[model samples]
Target: MTLRSGAVTALLTATLIASTAATAASTPAAPRGEGAGVLRVSTSTPLTTAARLQAAGFDLVESRIGTDLLVVGDAAVRSRLGRMGYRVTVQQTAPTTERPVSTGRTNGIAAAAATFYGGYLTADEYVQHLSDVAAAHPDLAVTRDVGDSWRKTQGLATGNDLVAICLTKLQPGDCQLTPTSTKPRFLLIGAVHARELSATELSNRFVDLLANGYGTDAEVTSLLDSTEVWVVPVGNPDGREIVEQGTTSPYLQRKNANNSLGACAVPPTSSNQHGVDLNRNFTWKWGGTGTSTNPCDQTFRGSSAGSEPETVALSQLMTTLYPDQRGPLATDAAPLTTPGYMLTLHSYANMHVIPWGDTTTKAPNDAGLRSAAFRASYYNGYQTGQPGQILYTVTGSTDDYLYGERGVAASTMEVGPNSGSCTGFTPAYSCQDGFWTANKPAMMYLAKAARAPYQLSLGPTTTSVTAPTTTVTAGTTFTLTATGNDNAYGTSGVGKPTAQTVNAGRYFVDTAPWNGGTAVAMTANDGSWNSTSEVAKATVPTAGLTAGKHQLWVQTRDSSGNWGPATSAFVTVG
Candidate 1:
């Protein structure tokens, strides 16, 4: 969703505001005395300092955090936050959640192409190839460094800055916060593993194909015109160079050029070369299983979390590109676990792995992850499961980190053109089209995942905290009471929903048994507007939908759009 510039900052944006504006006049006015005793206080004070005013001793019934409070029953707390520099309003707090669902988006894109031919360029050519592609499509493409990399790219991309490429047809002028963006930011990264050469080639080819299709192909042209496309062709540029220089034969180099692990580096560079595997260097499931410590071994987690410059650089980019969980720039204060679809390109095994990279156990939301993973992978001609479980467990993977830390849902796809040696990143050009035909759909799948606007979630307070995620049974009715709170519009003065929505009597799952089916989507309404959710499926397990920790959510709708009110929980499976 769009952020509010100038004096105010909105994360959920007015994406859902339109809904509230249209529906406020329609909500049957609350019963005379029902919830009438609740105190209402508004303030412009900072949220953290405003909490003290919400306690019962203070007689604070409902404390609204924002630019100015609309007072309901109490004027004391309002005045308190006000004396403390908060703008309080003594008005009735809305009985229900606001129709302010933010346009939650994923950093992925649909890479469906007409031919679906080819993978990425050579390891050495990965970056250059992307650069070349961007150059070729100057209108739709532009290159920028989101951040920096480690020593490998430090010299090349300027402190390892991400040499990112972006393509968009909408400008800030054309499509703005008014009607809300009909589009979202979609990301597709290739070569998280320096040696996964196919990813780089495939990503490059996808970009070129889209650029070429801008006017020629209908589907390609449509996607390009709709979403903002960003691609990181060579995630590990330095490693790629090493793989390329290692004799005429391309050796697999999964790590970055970080020599932190003294032994991780060795001479013959190609054969069993050393360095922290970039894949294993992320913050998620760090120092977990499926990782090695032989310095020379692959899948080695770095000395500590974020030890690599590459990892650090990417983290910085996330902070800058994405909203910050800290600082004056916080993008998503609530649990952003409602993930957009993501596809990370790897090599060899044709497996689509989901989250919980820390253990052999399935992720909390195994059902949702399983379904989306399978679907995305299926698009690309692959299978989906836990990376280690399906293929082998791994630690410090980028996908895990993105999902675990950033509230993003992502998957790793090991694209193999042929079954043999040619399958690695260096597959013969002859097999490119076959690889394209198989994986192009996966790219589309990710894009589709990203496009979904809303997500069912638990409390906005417990952000990224592990909860149950699984498939529900078909034709079965069940009450899932997992939810969180979010204030779509947050301001620096005295706004922002610091806490996730608490389980309310009328809105809780027990109060409202949501429709449980294969195609159950969700969104949020922050009382002012609403937004739609990503296309999340609530498939029921055949035997029955097992009980486990699950994300709680409410499906909301209004004139403007849909929003989310998801809950998080783990339960017993049947």
Candidate 2:
């Protein structure tokens, strides 16, 4: 959900109304109404009505297929929808106009949190945090200037650099801006729509999790050693600065600071604002459904495809980091060996949106995409589908461009629930930790799935690998246990995939099977692998092993012969 309109002053109120009506000709105007809030509108044709509302510049929140829409707007919006013959119900009113003051803790996580808002991070703070993380963990993280923001390119004083941080074990060619790399890449882009505060904060936490948990956490250690995780926090820094500058309330700025065309209001309101919607300014499926030609509208597609500097820079970065794996046809599917995965975070939409967002038509690799989305959504409990099937038809989104143009496996994760303290565009600061805890496992799953997304996503998952003790003496035998499940896919939304039986399981000591480690058979605890869930165990012989920490990698295979992603447990042979 992008914009929420409100009156700034008595004098400019009329002008704002006129501007909104003039720009949004498709939208009907009603008498001036008080109070701005969220609305749940019931409609028999949800998909059609969703697209209609989007085209009319309504702030349509993400909703499940065949369900009533959740919209954020004022009384006029309600009246207009009423005239259009829809039943609208107010969900909740906007918070008070008084901004919540921050305590301003200068050390640790509080420092990165927003000064005015307690949980969210400002654009400048996010950039500083990236630099601080890189400085504190040089061996595991490096920050790069991907491109310049719109204001920066315009030589404005308040501009910022489009920065990205890559986290991995720094090998010779690691983190370089090259398509060829020694390890697979998982790129997480956040806050492309600047008002989505939780997106940026989530990215920040992900960086912290991987960079700080390197050696101590077995999963994080194995992931960083085998994959390059990239984070582009605060993608629209200029607009984010405007959002940070909000005094009375947070500015719902959803676009870049390229106020070159329209006579938009100063200190942008929810409805009338100048700038291109960065998410809608991509080259693929540009200027289509769910986008507006009006510069004042929230979903304003730029003057041309990839017109915004931020959009161009992001596309260029993806091209540099990921090779084109699919053919030029719309029906062509990327191979199962595709090496990169991408997730763009948005707000107020509890959805894991797959590619081909502009239409309900499934992508060429819909099976793999849905499987991966379902697997990730298992942690977050989000609905998974194409944007048209889940929320509304969105064109020129980053996920669509990355998947359609560059052949990368990409999806958009709309964070936060529809209702609660953690809901809405600017959720309460206290909601950050809860959201992070809920999303961490899902993010980790997607990061690990980047290795072979199409193939690994189809197999059973090795949920856990455990030993009775992490430390053991030399020339000793220890039992290793693991839990494998083929039914780990999420069933919260449309297209619930069928689960397969876990037919086989194996464990490898000291090395991964791909690295020529010998596989040791693990017998099922229940004496058979006839069900979707299985518990397997094995005894490892450490007689010939050297005295040091060794990784025990465990993997499971489904009855269909698909090998899932590996889970590692460390055993110290001291």
Candidate 3:
């Protein structure tokens, strides 16, 4: 379902535009648990003759953009409508959600209630939590829906709708997006499974700490002011309700309450009773590898890519905010998200994962991703590496989708719900702070990601082809024209850089030269924007003709801001 598009014209006759202009034009299902490709489009094309376009089999993209939107419906119908001049983007239909299976020690049943009551923050509560904080500041707090989850059956058991929330710095346009760049977007999601109470607790505390510290903590204040942090405290409300029903027993159902296998696994003590693992249902691998079909296994592949409403809802939300890997949203926007990073909180594992969860192999950008993961790992005191490399080969993981399939920079910070084996639902509250403290570093790391997207693009890109005369006539300017690899508002790329300037990413000419006294040498710079590089040097003449023997030399630099090996040539006197 992954979609791609380009910047396009705006339409006054707008209905809905398809997600992408695939050769086959029609409304598509919400990418469901599949990778992010669905762009919802509605019927109606504007300006162009719909019939004329359709007969040619050309997808008449009537929306402002040429690409598609994640639409929900038959792709052919949507395309035909676009040809008829209806402005369409992807429409919402057939979305999905994932299931969870986290079997860990909780304090005995009697104490479980207190922990859930004190620690867990429901989606509604999350909103209230943020609102209360916003109420306190009013100036700093604002709410926005980055995207909506797939529509689903009313919680069959509790009959309640599911909810996800975003807690970030408010800005113009849609709350789902920031200005392509200028600020990094850090997403912190928790409670993908309802039973894991502490996951939500961590998020609740985060809101308070960040908002309250806008003035006290220098580091915290800087992050709140600059970074756009999205926090979804409770992702699966329906799944959580199931756990609530077993208040005393602490039932162990993993998947959302689809009841795919008999509707209920009363006193869920093993995978033989429950159905699929929601976390394993994402579209990236889409049953390609690491999926369970036994229905009773801990990880079950759904009917198709996105079978659950919960999975569908989250995918649509993520896709809209981030485009596909291929290219940009408009002539000016990034081709895709630069380094879209995310952190999904889980329990019972003292490990941090990178990518390629389906297999044991390493991903292409493992080093870079590892660098970012290390930032959080260092804080959590958790080990760093891939699932195969560290914990075991895990397939159908969200971290894999965020990094590989959907192009997000993501990692898993698995928190222990209980420190010891028997402590299950009733871990001591004293341990709460320790868990919170470990995750705080990772939270801070996420906040930093939102600060300017590492500004992969900064530079003194201006340079002048100059002579070594060491003197320029008065009023002479270099006529500098600056340019670099990364263009803002475009796809997220660290571009190319050297040790020039991490902030400005620039290169310049020496205002002063060797002036015949120093070691026959002149130095030039290469602006390594994001990484490191060497500097370049050229040779000067200690003795030459009477006074005017000029010389020509070539100097070069690399993306790492490294200078090139120098060579020289002779010039004749005037």
Candidate 4:
């Protein structure tokens, strides 16, 4: 499911030649949920290959820059591609069945009308669910119609409105679109590309879980009390309607139904062709590499940046809801001064991708971004990094736009298996439960992180040094004790933090003319310094001590790899 390559090759050759060389394999049901095999074409120029395949109608699943282009396609499509002189291989054969075994929900009798379809919800059902939750838990749940989708604004029969559900202990202006607020905020977007059924489903489940967890679950209760979570369960309603129309087999729809660019030039017929690729319609790096000029291409970049109403609305909402959290340009990282979190969910890739999708050059906040993403991958075990590194360089992507433009700590969660009976653009309903379970912890962690995403807040610190008056005998061993606290490894207020919660911490014995001293970590007499309390003690051996001033410095690192301010004890060993 997680593929990484390190080969280097010519960009031009990799792009033009690798398109046909890319192989699509059928998948067999595997216990690990790798539903089908993937077709891979090795390419150094992943951007070119990915774009070419997208234009050619192949679902460009993934791109391992130095290795190969992994796409999703069937036998007939592979045969056609093979005839085009590209190498073809049966990477994996799919099992006889590729559908989910169960619906994964026990809805009362009333659930039937909304659950008319096999495993997915009707557009109406999605809308009603939000309303129902708002009505039931008015205190903690509220719904806002951010804007109408393109189709809805244009009065198309397939149009559906865009909505967001906010779940927190509600207060005046708690979920309002504002740049400043008391609580840290998190935005979870789902189904930007309507065909990714699981994306929407998982978002829905998250909203329900949060709404239903109030008072009963202490952790959830604490999160709700402190953090504001906004869930856009469905981002592209028009495209979702088109996808819902396919009952026999899931529709292979990738773009919105915004047919303004003319006919659907790729595959699946003219009548079925829809709109721009919402993911590529953002304003940042709008028309760079990894996008298509052809309107029907899966990665179409729209006529102009922010052209689509869905794109416009989402961008506007972000600007209004979150003040610029980072500075401009790729050099700036999310600011610790005003940090917020945003995660846009997609399906089938199983990746936790950070920003700078347009290039591999590290983002200004690279350390913080990577730290947050790496921590998020703890539960699901997905590979985490920028698309340019893990997958392929993309422009105008949702994550890059949010992070690049507003300095928000934004990431994309490519949920579920990359290819399998339980994977693909849309996996079976039964597989929904697994994705939800795996991501539950990941989401909970993000909620906790929203609090101090940029800065590592330290707890009260205490320091002890051997010998009074800053003087000690030259031959005497000197003891230094430091203790601090942080919330990175545990939920801020829900339960007791323990050694298991802390990521890492250290004690440094700083000698005069000290650049940070290189030394072994200090030990705790009673295992004191850990996630729970972050305490450590170091004793400088008399053998290494000289007749000079020395200091003991201690700091604690949070789960995000951010170290809190250092605490120190001064001493002079003479």
Candidate 5:
């Protein structure tokens, strides 16, 4: 989302023209120029201006709902907006030179993934990484070919097969498409816009964390044992390939590589590109606000709802993974026992975008959704709200579709800061580590919450769990301490969650409570669990345990009868 800054403007003269023609049969006239730049147009009615510019085939960089519109185009764009009687300023011009590519491997899971632009993985590399993970961790990971990308559907060799990886400790009914599976499912999709390079990297790291940290990391091991984590790292492979081919200045392609609709300019610029904005092509609330009928525009909703193959493939994958827990009404809330959570990762906004993205209306399960968002933000410190409240409105987005049609607790994570070295769609590779460090906890929290998102989100969280000694001899006793906080939710966003008293706390050995593990009561440090935060301690005996590591899971309950997600610490019997 970061653009190179420049000084450019034009005098007011011509009137604004609204163009609608966007097919192969007819082409609407537009302002022509040499290079693209980000233009900020001051308008009294920003939303109306955004709609007009989108309809006229302008790529919107960002819209400050009430202040101004950030449009991306060339000098002609600046002139056109200026002549339309609105004061326009150039924020940044597109970079002219290509970024240096890197071949250094930063992590072990996907060594081949580092052979792309500054360590970012290509679409093919991402799919190969999934295969590598599945091969390396056969017991815990499996790769599935979900569907074909748009190009592949068109019988083009340049297309890619949509691939996803499921990570969990395999059991009899695990990783199946049936909605009645025993384990809760968490789905993470990245790079839906194709140009958001960091999204795919974060997805890869999450996979690596779960697949590699299974035996050593207690928290990850417990999650893998009890929950199913699915990741589609390259959601728009065709568009990502187009982005990968940008050796001379990264091609800012925001959509899939489908070029049959409109006569978009050849050698796509930052602003003028041909393809459907896959985010706007979903079935729910399609062709609504913040979308364009113009095929060349960035937010183009295709010829029909779910017209693009990529959109259809993703929607189908969701349907296969989750059951419809909600009734067929916008006001019908998903039951508290809903067992799925979904997150679509984007870049540069640094916000947790919740459902009802097409409008300002609150979702049916607004409290639950807000609580979950606040919990995630507690780790990443990102702003949380509906799309219209933080970024501009977006229709037919992945979160809205999943939450609306499938009744899954879903949201979109806009990664990266608004202004920094790590900002924008194409950030420096070094920024990946820092971003991963900041977001890993949030990702883990969301994945764990997938088990009972609505109910668990309202309960007190196990902030920390620890064992006094890492290694213990067989037939010995050890002390385990855990801290629970009913106020762990983030307070930087709308709808502050009310904190309840920590009524009770308990621990289980080597098993999750949902799987019928026997719970052991823990005594609070202050002699009672009557406060918002409490430290509970338990004496665990290892008399019959074998000489190996065991997971000590801890959970806390609120006064409202809600048991929070479990956290774990490792204890090894020597």
Candidate 6:
């Protein structure tokens, strides 16, 4: 997400690091203890180099082929690599420092808006906050305990239960996983990487705004009435607790607390020995090019696809909310009929990346995904594209898993510090304003867009039908006319080529006795519609009718994959 400032300098640095590549070192047993200090290691390829570093038990700070890795390890790391013939350079000698926790938050409703900017909250505080809102507004907010985090499952005091909050006026099956109703859905997940604290804060604030603004805000009320906004504010509670432990200068823990993988040879011990990168643990493209086998490494794919508890739970939640809206393979684009959208927030990179992160291959629904991301970026000003196109290749990521495997329209929003005044991983509490202010509109757009995420918002109605009389003789031919507009017009992020045109319609006729009819495509020009409200006509042949009365039905499908509301015209045969 952070494009290195000096391209030439970065390339030279990366080359210097790669040149030191030596013979593959023998795999060492899990470190008996942690190592310290910082080292810069480089590889010819970003993805492969990262895999090497992680596999070697190095705690990576940041990495890319263009930007040599910044890692944490002691002199033994240097010695081992020296023996292996790989070049290693000392970047810094000091231990990583923590950011001091801010003491400004009150966690009270009166100051709810201020709480988001105050500081990051503890896992318990987050749970309490969700409960508080649900308690205060029973009709508008509700919380569900989805599952227990890894730490909780381990019987540790630091572990916490996973929770999801639904902010909509409740009705039958409103928040349940069952897809029984007609309402559209938007799912927002935050803090999957424990170090990205702002994600959680932003999610919490969104929950607060929606639950509190119910009747007071017209737009919010209408949105809730028609759509469901589900938020999982803390997606990785075990890892979050580790990061929270170092409140003074929050500990940097990128993965969960599943210590089955032993500690890295890096200091600040606890995080190194445990956890899988929940982001890389998803089933789709799991264990592909940009992941690791070393459990101690930051981007380690778990023992198997969907291996981690966090991964399993979140994936289950997503499936529970949305059916596989797209076809089973890569060529199958999500049906325009699908009505789900997902956004998972991360930080330190001011970018909104579309799916297909597993490789450079474009998704079948790439057009819709790119269009939505570009439109969403208008409000936040974040660069948008498939991750492999804009950023580096990342396998088994949440967005890719959601979109590729489940056929949901999904993206990852890297929340803060695009460039100027870069705050890096944990930006100060004061910097929250810049993020929230810029993202408000984009977030709201996502909520409204859920109504028809994959479809163009166009509906056609039958305007008129002409025939000889109400009792037209059998074998008589007549015409039916109807009009429709691209309802998406004038809406922000809408009306692009993808959302502005209607393509075809299925036109059908039923005889006087109302014989069960098989529908067929409308013939010729009748099948196509254009303009804001253009009239489309269908010529009907009553050759097979039994006389008496008959009915005509027309339903149009827009170019953007939406089926317009059905329109009907009645005619009689004598």
Each prediction's TM-score versus the true structure? 0.53, 0.91, 0.55, 0.71, 0.88, 0.67
* Model 5: CA > 4 A from native: 1-37, 40-57, 62-69, 84-86, 92-114
Model 1, TM vs. native = 0.53
Per lDDT, the best of the predicted structures is 2
**Per-residue lDDT of 177 in model 5:** 68
Which candidate wins on TM-score?
A: 2
Off by over 4 Å in 6: 1-118, 264-273, 456-574
lDDT of each prediction vs. the true structure?
Answer: 0.46, 0.82, 0.45, 0.65, 0.80, 0.65
Lowest-scoring 10 consecutive residues by lDDT in candidate 5?
8-17
Q: Report the CA-based lDDT of candidate 1 relative to the real structure.
A: 0.46
Off by over 4 Å in 4: 1-39, 42-48, 51-58, 63-66, 74-80, 90-113, 265-272, 456-574
Query: Across residues 524-574, which tens digit of lDDT does each residue of candidate 2 receive?
Result: 988998999899889888899998888888999999999888888888887
For candidate 3, which ten residues in a row score worst on lDDT?
1-10
Query: For model 4, how does the per-residue alpha-carbon lDDT over 1-574 read when each residue is reduced to its tens digit?
Result: 0000112113322432333133222322211111223465656666666656655655577433235666555554555567766675654443223322222224332434344235577556676688779899999988888887887778855566688888899988798877787777889898888778888888889888888988755447657867789888888877775654432344456678787777753223211245888898899989887777777656777899999999988888788778876666566566565567888889866778887888888778775566566655656777777787777777888888878888877888888765556766656678888898889877776766676554533322222323235578888776655554443332211112232234455656653112436645666546644454555666766566777765555655555455643444456777
In the predicted model 2, the residue pairs found to clash are none
Each candidate's number of clashing pairs is 111, 0, 114, 28, 3, 11
Better structure of 1 and 6 per lDDT: 6
Candidate 5 total steric clashes: 3
Task: For residues 153-259, write the lDDT of model 3, one tens digit per residue.
Answer: 63232343434444445555324443354445567777665555556668767777777776545345545445556666766655554453332233334456565
